[model samples]
Target: MVLGAACATLATVAALRSGPAPHEDGSGDGGATGGPTAPQAGQALAVARQEFGLLSGGGWAQAWDLWTPTAQRAVPQAEFVRVNTECRPPVGVPYVIDASSVPDPTTVRVDWHRADTTGSATLSYRAGRWRFAPDARTLADYRPGADRLIQNRTAAGSCH
Candidate 1:
């Protein structure tokens, strides 16, 4: 009885942590309906928060994975890691994330304010799930003499 009860509790916790059951198509949508579901929308915000936590925790490579393909290409892996780690938010420890709005079923905006600074990031639905700034671009002349064609789009701002 004790063993069964423990197993049941663990299962319940796992289920709660995992959130909604994704569709058979694995879109995390309500399944067969059409657009993004409540669970999927909640998951998007969760992903956005996870990305911020990853960055604050110094998981540079993992955080890099959160960027869109365009953003990834705009900045080289080494350069991205260097710049981000160098410019990490001054927020001391136990970084906080406060999600404000989901502009649409497919997008979310989360905020962070600390150490006398405030910033935010936006995530959008992609092939199947949420991603940070699925259309990030670099600042003008961010790369000098690299001959890289600049993409002009909303940049994933600081600490994103």
Candidate 2:
């Protein structure tokens, strides 16, 4: 199962690199790199790609490291490990972008699928970058009864 998940992760990364080049605002004056202005949607896509790379490379710590701070605050590493262990799907072609859009400059919504599971995640732009979380909403907004697509809410774990 781990092998399959790893494959999935790699496939996802490859898909990302093959897609359109990402554009971010070069707003950071004075030798700053990877600045904001990169649309929130683009930033979310990049984060997802990095997460997949971490998983594919047997770098669970790195993969977890890619999660948003908000996500980290919401769910810890132990739970992340547990959920990933249970949810890792079988190896298949990496999930396509399915669809992506920014509801607002600060929020990005992406619909993604792998084999049997399909879901969407909401990301927020912070520090001029994007981070994934449970839609940046109230617990009630994330409740299964409230949103059907929020299949998982596990956050990124620690680097170590």
Candidate 3:
């Protein structure tokens, strides 16, 4: 009986040390919350923050690099830089991450706002890393007239 108890204790310790059990989909349960693990969420949020930081800091090319390959294919680099440059946000404007959620094991959806502008972006985990994935509407709006659209969306002259 003592031997059996020792073995059981060892097994319990091992399980505890092994971290949270993965769900059937092979994603960590994040301890009863039913979403991406904390590390996964942090990584995704870090990507979102970094992308926005780069954009706000006028590192447009670097910010564009954070985009998922699929999003990059949908929106060319030059066009993205051009539109954003034309409607750059004011210096020191703060963007708040409103909320984030796991849409899937490999995707995080982040809702954010800055002054009068609000948006949602998807971060995809692929190739062992996270990347920003703009939605279809965003891709469509990043065209030649995007400056006017962005200015109109934000308080007049706020994003100019």
Sort by TM-score, best first: what order? 3, 1, 2
The sequence of per-residue lDDT tens digits that candidate 3 reaches over residues 13-72 is 344335555555534453565554444776777777777666655777877887887888
Instruction: Give model 2 RMSD, 1 decimal.
Output: 9.3
Per-model root-mean-square deviation over C-alphas: 9.5, 9.3, 14.2
- Against the unseen true structure, what C-alpha lDDT does each candidate score? 0.55, 0.53, 0.70
Stretches of candidate 1 exceeding 4 Å from the true structure:
1-39, 85-92, 134-160
Q: Report clash pairs, candidate 2.
A: 24-38, 25-37, 25-38
Which of the two candidates, 1 or 3, achieves a greater TM-score against the reference?
Answer: 3
Q: Would you list the clashing residue pairs of candidate 1?
A: none
Q: Score every model by TM-score.
A: 0.56, 0.52, 0.66
lDDT (tens digit, per residue) of candidate 1 on 1-160: 5345334533543443453445665555544456654436666555655565555556667666766655767766676565545555432243456556867877777787644556777777754556677333342223433322322111324443
How much is 70 displaced in model 3, in angstroms? 0.9
The C-alpha local distance difference test score for the whole of candidate 2 amounts to 0.53
84-142: candidate 2 lDDT, tens digit per residue = 44444232335545888888877877888754557777766654445556544532332
Q: Which window of 10 residues has the lowest lDDT sum in candidate 2?
A: 151-160
